[model samples]
Target: MKINSKKVTVQKSSQALCEYLSDVKNFEALMPDNISKFELIRDDAFVFALKGMPEIALEVKEVEAPHKVMLGALSDKIPFQLTANIETINANTSQVELVFEGDFNPMMAMMIKSPITKFLETLAGNLEQIQ
Candidate 1:
């Protein structure tokens, strides 16, 4: 599996950060406009109907109130598990860390890694812009 992580500190109250992070809908808004379609299914997962974005479906595996949230995903083509962790630094700051683990066959690793990295980058960029 390919692994990538990023940390972003938002200059907002942790309560507000937690509120936004807890809502899957906020991701849709924070994510780049290039994502034409995105939805969090009732199963506590998000599905991106388009390809080449990143994990096809992301499942919310764990959540710690006002502190951390973890989501796991298996690449659409590869057999790797992608886990993203968002942690709150304090009432006025927060950080996000991502971990992708699995034994993916050859080239699929490259294909999956790039987009995941890009998404995390975009997420951090968006978070920095968020008050």
Candidate 2:
């Protein structure tokens, strides 16, 4: 299954956005309001829990410098890769869209689609306020 987030324009350049995303610690600011818990487990990994979901561990899986950052689920229970796609709009502006690719049975996909989409959209929307 694949889900795409809404594109958002950010005030920073793609390089700057990617730099911020490269650090797991920096993601604390982009968390949704429903995030019940968040903890940095390593320089490139973290664990977080939403109000009603299990705490999931995620790590920075791959980074393509100023273009893309891919984070993957640390648990096989929910196999997925979330990619942050950054586009250069200008010297001081960039665009961000999140793509979530998950391996789930059709039934499981139908069950989690709504909440997952909201989660991705919230994270993408928060990119505009990255500091």
Candidate 3:
């Protein structure tokens, strides 16, 4: 299934945003208060676990300067790809949105759709409040 976050305008420039996202460590700042585990594997990869979920390892798989970034999980248990699309509005401002796609069967998709959408919204909202 595919889910997209509402585009949010933030004070950060695209370059700065990309720089911030390219570092896997910064993802902790975007996570919710329930994050139970966050372990860095490399400068661009880490494994994390939420309140009730199994641990998942993710890496910043790809990045296009000042525009796009793609993060992918290493575990096959929950196959998914997440992309962040950034648009420059000015030198001091930009818009950011997230697209999440997961490979899951019909029943699994139904069960996860709501939480994934909520997670996307939370992620987008965090972008605005992040320094």
Candidate 4:
């Protein structure tokens, strides 16, 4: 199975948005209950608990702060990863778009998509709440 996604744009400065996304620690606080016990391993890398699932751990494989972040699931059950890419259109304006892809069992694959979408929506809302 393949994971695909996208997101709406944000009206924020690129540098400012990058600054906000620079620290992995900040993201943990913004994540909703679907995620729990979040931790940053190194720089933009991390391992976090995913709720309502198999207690899966997520790790950041690649990242460019507010511009983009690629994450992978470390769970045996799910073989999926997500790449969140953000762009700054103009001063005081930015946007976040995501691409996801993975190989998983039929039921698990179906289960992940919608929740992932919801999580992204929730994440966006939380981000907007800041600044």
Candidate 5:
């Protein structure tokens, strides 16, 4: 399953946003308010739990400077990759897009599509306010 978030314009430059996201500690500001637990185990790894979901470990898999950052699930329960792409709009503005790609059975995909879509959209919208 693959879901793409709506693009959002942010007041910060791509470089600034990239710098912020490059540090896992700054992710707290971008997380959903319902998050029950969050821990940064290393510079590139962390564990977090949502209101009713099992704990999930995520690791930053790759980064392309101010262009893109890719993160992947480190838990077997959920196999997925989340990518944040940043595009420079001007010296002080950027366009950001989020994509979630998950490996799910057809039945599971049908059931969680709406919720996952909403989650991705919310994440993107929240990220827009990072400046």
Candidate 6:
């Protein structure tokens, strides 16, 4: 399954936003307010638990400097990759997009489509505050 987040225009340079997102610790600020547990396992990995959902662990899979960062799930329960793509619009602005690719069967995909879409959009919108 593929899910794309709404694009957000951030009032910050692409490099700045990329640097902030490169560090796993900074993800706490991007998490949903309803998350009950968040733990940083290392610079590249962390685990978080959303309300009523199983704990999810993620690790940085790839980082392309000021352009993109990819995170992959560390659990067999959910095999997915979440990527953040950054485009420089100008010296003081950047456009950010989030994409989520998950290995889910038709039944699971149907069950998760709505909530996951909303979650991805929320994450993209919140990128505006990272500056």
Candidate 5 local lDDT, 8-118, one digit each (tens): 998988988877777778777788888899999888989988898778788899889898988899886879988989999999998988998999999999988897787
Worst 10 residues of 3 by lDDT: 26-35
Better of 4 and 6 by TM-score: 6
Question: For candidate 3, lDDT tens digit of each residue in 1-131?
Answer: 99999999888999999998898898888887788999999988999888887788988889998899999988878899889999999998999999999899999999989978988888899988877
Model 3 earns a TM-score of: 0.95
lDDT against the true structure, each candidate: 0.64, 0.93, 0.90, 0.69, 0.86, 0.89
In Å, residue 89's CA in model 2 sits off its true spot by 0.7
Q: Model 5: runs farther than 4 Å from truth?
A: none
TM-score-better candidate, 2 vs 5: 2
Candidate 6 lDDT over residue span 1-131, tens digit each: 99999889999899988887788888888888888999999889999888987788999999998999999999878899999999999998999899999999999999989988987877886787766
On the 0 to 100 scale, the lDDT of residue 2 in model 5 is: 92
Residue lDDT tens for model 1, 42-77: 556677643445436766666676666665563455
lDDT of 6 at 92: 87
Which lDDT tens digits does candidate 2 get at residues 83-122?
Answer: 9999999999999899999999999999999999999989
Worst 10 residues of 2 by lDDT: 122-131
Highest TM-score: which candidate? Answer: 2
TM-score of each: 0.71, 0.97, 0.95, 0.72, 0.93, 0.95
Model 1 spans with C-alpha error above 4 angstroms: 49-55, 74-90
* Alpha-carbon shift of residue 33 in model 5 (angstroms): 1.6
Candidate 6 lDDT at 125 equals 68
Evaluated with lDDT, which candidate comes out highest?
2
Model 1 clash pairs? 14-91
lDDT of 4 by residue, 1-131 (tens): 65444455666676676666655677787788767667776776566666755454666666676687777776656677776678878888887766677886778768777877776677777766666
Better of 1 and 6 by lDDT: 6
